[model samples]
Target: MKLRIFHQTVYRYDRPARNLVQSLRLTPSVSEGQRTHDWQIDVQGGIRGPGFRDGAGDWIEGWTVRGPTEEVTVTVTGRIETRDTAGVLRGHRELINPLAYLRDTPATKPDQALRDLALTAKDAADPLGLAHRLSAVVSDAIAYMPGQTGFHTTAAEALEKGEGVCQDHAHALIALARLHDLPARYASGYLHTTADGDAHEAAHAWAEINVPGLGWVGFDPANRCCPDERYVRLGSGLDASDAAPIRGIAAGHGIETMDVAVSVEEVERFQTQSQSQTQS
Candidate 1:
């Protein structure tokens, strides 16, 4: 299947600030199951800065506006060709080491609740089964509620609250998988749902677990399903903070406000192929 994605983010500040810096990880890399045909990013208000060069994880930054600044808009548009491998991403190309994925971040610490959840899946024979079980457990345990957790929310905190958005769900699952000696990575992307029409919100997150034969398999605990062709893998890291689409700091502030919108549309399969052949 092929997909066309349009993501737009707007930031409005009450007072302009000085010395602002942001990291952006909005670019998508082609992999075995996915191919990038055409991708472009447009900035309206602020200047695009250099992304982090030396890092094993994805670098996310935002634009900065000096004091007396008001608004910034970032628009990203792209088209990608994807094949569904039953959530199996194969090929030996190692963009990220499996060992590195096994490492846990501060916000993904597995507390007693997470550890107990993993213990329930310990009897599974294979990694795929474990992933299935984990997805089911998380979907059943937590309600999808926004504003429940922020960038600082930990797995333990989210599990205790019993409610969070996709990031929280993904983080909890990552912690549990790592505790069980499974190498798991955090995936950042956009999810398009027919129920929601054309409204884009914050970035979406999920978890990918490594299997012996199949390599890495992705699971969206929030959606209660494995990632298929409809899913777009943008970037990945140990946790949501690492793979965040945008993050930054400002020097001076009187009051800051932020607004974000994202939209993903699945391009018609026939149209995508025709476009591909025309470009060729």
Candidate 2:
């Protein structure tokens, strides 16, 4: 299946003065089951700088603005063709190694509750079944509500409140998986809206677990389903902080506002022969 995606992020400040720097991880990756085509990034109110591959193999672009800037907008547009191998991403092409997915991050330190949950979940011989059960548990346990926690909120806190957004869901799952020595990482991406409803408000996140033979499989505890063709795989890390789509700093401070809009749509597939015949 082929998909076209457009993501726009805009930030406006009440007052503008001095310097700003931002790290962007907006590019989609091509793996064994997916192919990328015609991907581009555009920035308004800032100059384009060099982009390097990070430790997670994500394309990283650094942008800096000096002196008197009120707003910044970053837009990324791309087309991707993906095939579903039944949720099995073959080989170790991903930047985040499964073994090191649980190497310890400040935000994802699991406590006794999380560890106990992992032990309970891992008792299943089928990892996919275990993941499904865990996803259901999270979805049923945590109430989907905003303003409950911020980016700095930990898994323990989210568990305590029993409510959070996608980040909190992904983090809790990651912490639980790590406790059982199952290599797991946090995935940040967009989920295509179904015909049943309108689009989601912002970027989405899920957790990826590395099964022994099946490789990396995604478990979206927030949505309670494995990532299918509708999900676009972006950057990943041990937790949300590392895989956040946008991270930057501004010298001036009052209160800053951020808005993110993403659109992912399924593209119609046309026969290659028809195009060839048209050319002829």
Candidate with maximal TM-score: 2
Cα displacement (Å) at residue 7, model 2 = 1.5
TM-score of each: 0.83, 0.86
For model 1, how does the per-residue alpha-carbon lDDT over 74-131 read when each residue is reduced to its tens digit?
7889888877777776542455568788888898888788888778888877777887
At residue 99, candidate 2 shows an lDDT of: 92
> What digit string (tens of lDDT, one per residue) describes model 2 on residues 60-150?
8988778577777889998888766665655435454679886767677887777666666666768667766677777776777888889
How far off is model 2, as Cα RMSD? Answer: 4.5
lDDT of each: 0.75, 0.77
